[model samples]
Target: MIKRAIALAAVLAALLTAFAVPAQAASGRYFYGVHAGLAGVRDYHGYVPSTYRPGTPMPLLVALHGCTENSFGFDLLTGFSALAEERGFIVVFPDQSTLANPAQCWNWPLPTNQHRGLGEPSLIAGITQKVRSQYTVDSARIYATGISAGAVMSGILGVTYPDVFAAVAMGAGCEYQCDILAQRDPDEQGRAGWREMGSRARSVPVLVFQGSADPVVPPATAGRVIEQWAQTDDLALDGADDGDIDAVAESVVRGSVPGGRTYTHSVYSGPGQGSVLELYMIDGAGHSYPGGCSCSLYGDPSGPDASGITWDFFLAHPRR
Candidate 1:
């Protein structure tokens, strides 16, 4: 068992390579439509920035909206449209249907929907692949990020479809488990459902954002996500027996975002010092995307911009 674990870790570690982040968005065309998938249909709206050239491949970022929120509403709430227009990347917003959930939420908190090639994960992955095949996209530079329930779905994408995303950023989200958001399993294996879903992307990089004062989804919920990824990074690097960050952590960076949140940034190095897990604990913010607009529907505008922060993180990590 130990030998097999060591061999698998080495092979996965070798898969990480330096990636070049693209600049400038396309001026070609923007479209909104519905995609038919095995699970169901998903509505998506995308923007091709003005900075884009005709033939150059651009990075793709899939931004998911929270419950009761539509794609256009989330674009306003997070100012992602404005960022994409300036930063030069393709941004896709996938909307959840009321039929899936009465609140229009991604069914990520359910065990049935948590695995790969099934439920909402399959639908979203199909959309990502469709976008990649349609436009000039950097296949290795694809990424995902979301707020609240959307944030939870982003975690699911990172775990279940790492092959589709380079990395995932989650804000005020919980782990990829069934009912754990409202109920705790309390078992080691049960709590680590993230590891069980898929091992192909077991050590895929993760960026977490949690509001210290979030009212809707507290930092405790985000803590579970950070802890899960941190432990998975440990098991991948040195096996389950030595899964402890305090001892294996390569470095810890701590500071504040001007006058807003005093944040702690922890990085766990995988096989080649490739940073695999990161946590940003935002101080004094509500259940909204940090550094976002005063849109009120999704996040607090007085803080640092989550869009800019996420783009920077995604730029540094890519699937090999």
Candidate 2:
């Protein structure tokens, strides 16, 4: 009977681990009334570092929540608000609307929603703009990030509105175009469209965390995302992988977590040694943020520290 009870307890724990829940925001306030054109309105919440003062322009991080996730839950998972408080920056989380998607997802896989200045992308950018307008925000240092669906949307924002976002980070996500046909590889025309859009938008730096054995998003998609972002940010319109458009260099480093999984960190550089793309491919990580708060719903503490590493990347690459 003791073994039966223990087995049942283990089963319950496994169920909880699989079904993720969003954490409540720690900065404590959930604000509303901010509206984006056509996309309607959603709740906004965040935390300001203790050192911040009124009228001082602070850097803003606009984080988007994944399906069935809330701003507060997102805050608890990534611990970005806590990091913001500690590092003297600002972090804002925007909730997804059920009207757009029943799951409250960002609608990243839809073809119609993939374009710039339209669909959910516009709404997200509007939230960032609204936050900037209300607060003393540093226009040049704004950034975006998310988990899963939200992460894919972050990639869309980076391509769609590069002028607004200085840098982007995504976990267990795909590129801007994740339609069914684009799953294996994006067609030539679609790839060209992304390249053109990114070029016109003044492409920003991107950081991606992809689980090698991701069950939802095929891990191959992450490599494709890197290829698209690297070529697009570099403005390489050439069709071949080994093309002489400009200079593309990559450096690789390997590391492991103590009593946990090992991972590979790859940084892709463009002209002037600027980091255009960074990829962390964790060997055993699933569909969650690496080194994130395990106590939170959607996190795996066995990988690299995402909040810390991504923030460092954000600081290094401001809008050019």
Candidate 3:
């Protein structure tokens, strides 16, 4: 049994290394480096727009990649860097070490990495702080977005580091402790997230995109995530789960990309805030980044423009 386990470990390590950290082609705006924080060291990449000035504070978006993907390739798949350049914001990509997870996943399922001031959450926050320190980042406009495992990690960050991340965008993923593999009650998972927030709890605007036909993550996962965030936000708003955020009526819109997939968009708003939560359910879409470049394995050219929608939502809702 020991020998078999060792062999399995070896194979997994090899597979992870195969797609680990490829050297990205040179781009003057794009840069890479390593950061060592209290938890550990991690590799990170940053994209600074050409219009950025030294003293000007621009919005910062932290993009986290899913399993089997790396920081260097996420932009290629999602076209986030291009959007950042056009929108005049700084974007950072925090890499996951293969040693941490054999599949290069963010380890969101592990309780050790779910809370504040511990594990992968700390490392990712450290990376975001490092970027803010180096670049002229608007603290109020800092946001996080990711896909799959990275999406789950983004939800965890919203709970554990609410002050650090003003809002979060998750694609093809579930909420914190929702555990797509285990499939628990979203309300319970949401309460757990609220507890994790502790005294730092606040309303963190969320943008979620889910594929209707996603095989790895069920379509119902989107509803689960929405429920979790609504519950968490409800508790955060008044320290009591009184159906505050949930009581607000959600506006739904149906649309489709030309010759692509159709989708349903839902927006949930707070009492004063325009929108605290937005969900996009893409019909017939698979477990891939919708409206992304098809160059990468996880990118799908069909469906709504998720990256664009996420940015618009992030821009609308800052740390207020």
Candidate 4:
């Protein structure tokens, strides 16, 4: 009887091991928890590279997920956690609850969610702050990136919390106040974004990625995001609406993945320093995360490596 009982215990342990969650890898620490802040309660997942030390400050990145997505799935879709381990940065993925939006989308279009210290933006920022409290984060090197609705919220973060995020990256997303700007042009949208920034306004560097063949988010919307950010930076530079920050591409480099979609890389110079905006237009690609894991529905492995490009951009543009 004793032998039989021990054998059953061993079988149970094997079953538990088989069903256990997989770790990020042997090289990094991956964790998840809930953060209750002034805005509300938010669930989040995080990854810290093995290279991180107790006293050393590491760059922090907040990655938001799109509709029908959650923090864990986004982490797998973009492969940002692996990238973080390789690059020695900390990454946080904030989950959107179904209760907030039935589709599990970030409320980027609503007025309440578009401003500073309000709604989803505040909740996301609160999550970021919470991560900071628990980790050694470099204040000036903090960055934000997202896809679809998540991408729109990333832009709103740049507008509403300019002091917190040093740079922004959008994937298959439109400009700030995109829903309301349907009748307006990119220039008008830029003005609205600048106004949204208010006194905390600064020229936040932005990187954009889009699929020319994307049926969900048309290429034009991505183009609007590029132009709108340029206009906002123009205004932020000298408090004037003048187009000092040229939206025109300083250089256009065309490339193609081995057997995948061809792409155009455009660089737009900023008002004061280096390129403020970089646009990657992937031809023939659909609405998906470029160069993401094939395991996810939104992942497009054959496209350009957006995650790598985003990290490089963030590293290049620390807050002054």
Candidate 5:
């Protein structure tokens, strides 16, 4: 009778443990209405590591989605939330107002949107402030990353809110807006725009990733952006060199910046960062996250893993 009682107690304990473990692992999702323009836009987000508790400060990463894309799509495609789990960071995805643009693209270039006090930049800043108030977030460690249109917006955010974001990573996007201007020649206006954009965030470090074969945004544009940032930092140019060209068939060019870091221009090697700018050029790859699902119009699985590489870069540099 004594043995049976002991066995029954053990069984009950095992059952309780099984139930409690899953309950502890469950994650919660939250939604809030953010005021953008005259109407309030609903922003949906999921905070991961489900184990996060109050008073625990964690690094925050704001992941923006591309045109015609939503938060759920970006979360599924990049799987960055998984990185948050391992790194113990809070990841937020802010949805673009589709009412403004049917495709839900970020307004990165419009003069009205580019200003510090209004438009998309303000909306994103508001989101960050809201999250900071609700959670214990490290202000100095705040970062932003995105895809395509969202990537362009990330650059915009870095420039407009340099005091807010510590670092930024852009995939398949350029430093300046690619739109054509009416008063200026296409080529001349493009160059001037890049220089102006570079001037805004002269001190902020940036990581840029582009596909060599990307049809949407040319690979050369990525190189130009890196050069602009390097020049802004007054870094010595190291010229071009081959990077991961054999196995992955990538090439790179490196330059030294004022700090102990070097600016790198890669054309196929795994993702890496230099001083103020780092470019990852995927050889034979198109405008998609490498090693991820080939769901987009331009996606290649044979290139370097961008999600992992970008996260690593962000971890190395915190806001100084």
Candidate 6:
């Protein structure tokens, strides 16, 4: 059993190493969509690993872009496609509807937008379903991740569609605050809707990555989200600790979300998840992708390699 476990770990590590880090020469595809008879199309880019086969059920990762960026920007900045090529997974980068928000931001905080039947979350869920129908996807292994506003959307998805996504890696996002805001009586229906959606996220495993120095989303917001998720999962709370830091200088901290049968928390470095929830706190970073690389915008050269870390966390847990 020991030798078998060692071999499994080695295989999983190698798979993650090949697909989690950034690389060059990643391919992209554009998927056209027309929703509810709307005469418009959204662009989604798919990145498949070099070793992908037609019949194999590969995992899928959906990468969402931040405000002011499109699907293409997400592809250029995160370099996840390179990792997809190595890991033998399918990665889909969905473009936000410019018509909905001029800045292309996901309406994560709004209650109506968080629902499943209609709105952006539904659109995304539709996209995922469509992709699965067209490809050999391991439905149980589907995951999501994003930057800034995109991170918030990821949270919404985890909460709204707990069955669709196994885990989520949210970078620089926050919890659903509509309930608190609605206490002021802004919109009673909206508040109720938000709470309803929040209730749906009880089973999803989330790995949150936030930079302490991010100006867009305060680092404290990340902590609050971790706590919120912990409560939602009905897990006993454990204390927090610092995880690993990278050569670029970014650091991570983690706390446990107690499941009745298992204990799960974010780890800076270790084997993948056997527990329920994990949170990754990126220290001294900004609202950008990490690693020792340079880019035009939103790429921190002095931070830890986040792409690799995000993938590691995603691989550790499947949807439960």
Best candidate, lDDT-wise? 4
Clashes of 1: 7
Q: Which clashing pairs does model 1 show?
A: 25-51, 25-52, 25-88, 26-52, 288-299, 291-304, 291-305
Task: List candidate 6 segments past 4 Å from native.
Answer: 1-23, 26-41, 178-202, 235-273
Candidate 3's displacement at residue 1, Å, is 29
Candidate 1 stretches with Cα past 4 Å from truth are 1-29, 178-199, 236-241, 244-254
Pairs with backbone N, CA or C atoms under 3 Å apart (clashes), candidate 2: 22-73, 23-72, 23-73, 24-72, 25-72
| Candidate 5 lDDT, 178-260, residue by residue in tens | 44223333334323433444434334567888777777888777755554344322321121122211122245575432332
Query: Candidate 6, which ten residues in sequence have the lowest lDDT sum?
Result: 240-249
For residue 237, model 1's alpha carbon misses the true position, in angstroms, by: 5.0
Which should have the higher lDDT, number 1 or number 6? Answer: 1
TM-score of each: 0.82, 0.83, 0.89, 0.91, 0.71, 0.72
Question: What C-alpha lDDT, on a 0 to 100 scale, does residue 101 get in candidate 3?
Answer: 84
How many backbone overlaps does candidate 2 show?
Answer: 5
lDDT preference between candidates 1 and 2, better one: 2
Q: Per-residue lDDT tens digits of candidate 4, residues 96-129?
A: 8777788999988788987898898999999899
In candidate 5, the residue pairs with backbone N, CA or C atoms under 3 Å apart (3 or more residues apart, or in different chains) clash, namely 243-251, 244-250, 245-250, 250-268, 251-267
lDDT of 2 by residue, 1-320 (tens): 99999899668644542342224334433344446578677767666666777799899998887888766667777878768866778888887766777888888877656777777888778878887877799888999999899998898888778778888999988765665346444434335545547545465688999999888878877777776676565453334444322223468889888988899888887657467788889997788878877886577888888999999999999887
Give the clash count for each candidate. Answer: 7, 5, 0, 0, 5, 2
Q: What is the C-alpha RMSD of each candidate to the true structure, in Å?
A: 12.7, 7.6, 5.2, 5.7, 12.9, 13.7
- Model 2, C-alpha of 96: deviation from truth (Å): 0.6
| Model 3 lDDT tens row, 1-320 | 99999999668745543333223322327767798877788998777877889889999999999999887678778777777777788888998988888889988878888889899999999888888888888989999999999999999999999998999999988877866565577788888989999898898999999998899999988888888999999899989888878724479999989988899888898778778888888999899999877768887888788889889999998997
Candidate 6 — which pairs collide?
49-85, 166-319
**Whole-structure CA lDDT of model 1:** 0.72
Per-residue lDDT of candidate 1, residues 1-320 (tens digit): 99999899556433311010122223334567688978899888777787767579899999998988766667767766667778788888888987888898888867767778888988888888888778889888999999888988998887678667888999888866634544653234223644554455345678888888888875677656766666654554444535543223466777777666666666766666477777777778778778765644566766667788888889888876
Which candidate leads in TM-score? 4
